[model samples]
Target: MEHEATRITGTDLDPEAAFQRRLGAVVQAVEERIAALLDDAPRRGEIARPARLVAAMRHAMLGGGKRLRPFLVIETAALFGVPFAHALNGACALELVHGYSLVHDDLPAMDDDDLRRGRPTVHKAFDEATAILAGDALLTLAFDVAADESSHTDPAVRAAFVQGLARAAGLGGMVGGQMIDLAAEGRYGDVLLDEARVRRLQAMKTGALIAFAVDAGALLGRAPLGDRQALGAYGRAVGAAFQIADDILDRESSAAAMGKRTDKDAGKGKATLVGVLGLERARRERDTLVEAAIAALASFGAKADILRSAARFTASRQS
Candidate 1:
């Protein structure tokens, strides 16, 4: 049997390629803007203080990355008729939080990784203390950026955005996920965790920020409650798929391509779908989650074309 080829146009023109291209543009623009903002800080101008910490912070913040979370924020906002420019700062703030987490995660106390995004880990490039402070600064600055006047017009909206981000990045979200991951080492070898436990860990770790990214956009754009809920569902599904793909990639992708060390999960004895269900099954799970993500966007119609493409990219990306 011959399969029919699907035609794509406008926002549907090779969604993964389009997302990569658009994401590059967004990330570059945001990086430049953030750099300018960081330069304006009084600490940067002061030569008497230890600028190494600031430089380490900048190195980690400005390091090249896919900016996936930020891209979600921008694309989701566009689905609600909000312009990308209006959502840039919020997107940037999300990236800041993500970057900070990575910096801290690579520390000796955490993953003890020596490389990140093809560069030396913060703790390796700089001192451990400086890296810790850099991570701390970026985390704090994330909320500061979200609450800035330029990011939001209404105080209530700004407050909600800030709160959402804090929840995602704090103990209830990413931190909690990390705690679970750390605990699972060596213990998950023979333990068969149920679906609920898997979903709980993934939701707190990856889905939390992704959910925040989508919901923040809806909140900022003043989207309807139904639309917000739909986007949140989409974000959660995509986020889980993203992590699953990441787990697969950890086994298959090159360290250079990933911009981070690979095989760390297996080396650390961490629990992942791949470990529990085998590679083929894990891949199938990724596809299923991606479909759910796309289905969640059915309400947005053409307005969600970018997001749909992003969902496809989530399952297909090699790194």
Candidate 2:
């Protein structure tokens, strides 16, 4: 045990397996917490709404997925010795935002998909209006969850969490990237959306929330400003790699595996690194970004191996 604590090494079989198992547990824990919160929240006015709206929101929120964003929030907090229960309380907010985004994204006005997490999309399961309302409700609930005082001991910490969530899920982040994505359609052959633009769009669309997830942990734990900043940078890098992996999967994987439509980006003629650069080049870029993400954790020494494993997993994941 002493040797284990003092050992210094990169990600190996044991750590990788441990990381996967931990991620699985964190995903389950976050899902359970979010469900319970949704169930009990209306009594507290945390999120009160019609039963139909609540059901739609529940449909969109609780389903099968990686829950990677929540994983980041909890594990990063653990790096600073924050208890999993405390970190989980705040991390659920990010997952709500993510679920909201997915629900709306699959609407006829957006990505227009009919499946999510291997089930009928909210819009398809109910109606378009219900799906829209569910997304709006979830987004509102996310801020409420972030600001809840019970999640943290300090008011300032709760404020930071709320503010961070706003920025990451706001116009400058996910929403803005989505606008770029919708606008970039069919501009594949044009210079309107170059590589840089696409990457920025990717950063905003996917990376911002991820960076916020990792940063949320540090904020709740009151980690040093310097370490928090480093983790933010790490999150951005890992987020990029994660998107690139998605691009790869879209090109190669089946819709059954992803539980949603595949090749949609290419079909839309959207700008992607895989479409801009070739597959090999995108793979190289993803690898490079993963290394950068890992490098950003150097400040944490051997203790950061879990994060390193996460970055590698982002680049290598099949779905």
* Model 2 agreement with the true structure over 70-151: per-residue lDDT tens digits: 9899889988988777787788989999999999999998888998888999999999999998899889878888887777
State each model's CA lDDT, in order: 0.81, 0.86
lDDT of 1 by residue, 248-296 (tens): 9998999989988898888887768887788999999999999999999
**lDDT at residue 249 of model 2 (Cα atoms):** 92
Candidate 2 residues lying further than 4 Å off, grouped into runs, are 1-13, 46-48, 186-191
Best by lDDT: 2
Residue 30's lDDT in candidate 1: 75
Pairs in steric clash, model 1? 117-259
Give TM per candidate.
0.90, 0.92
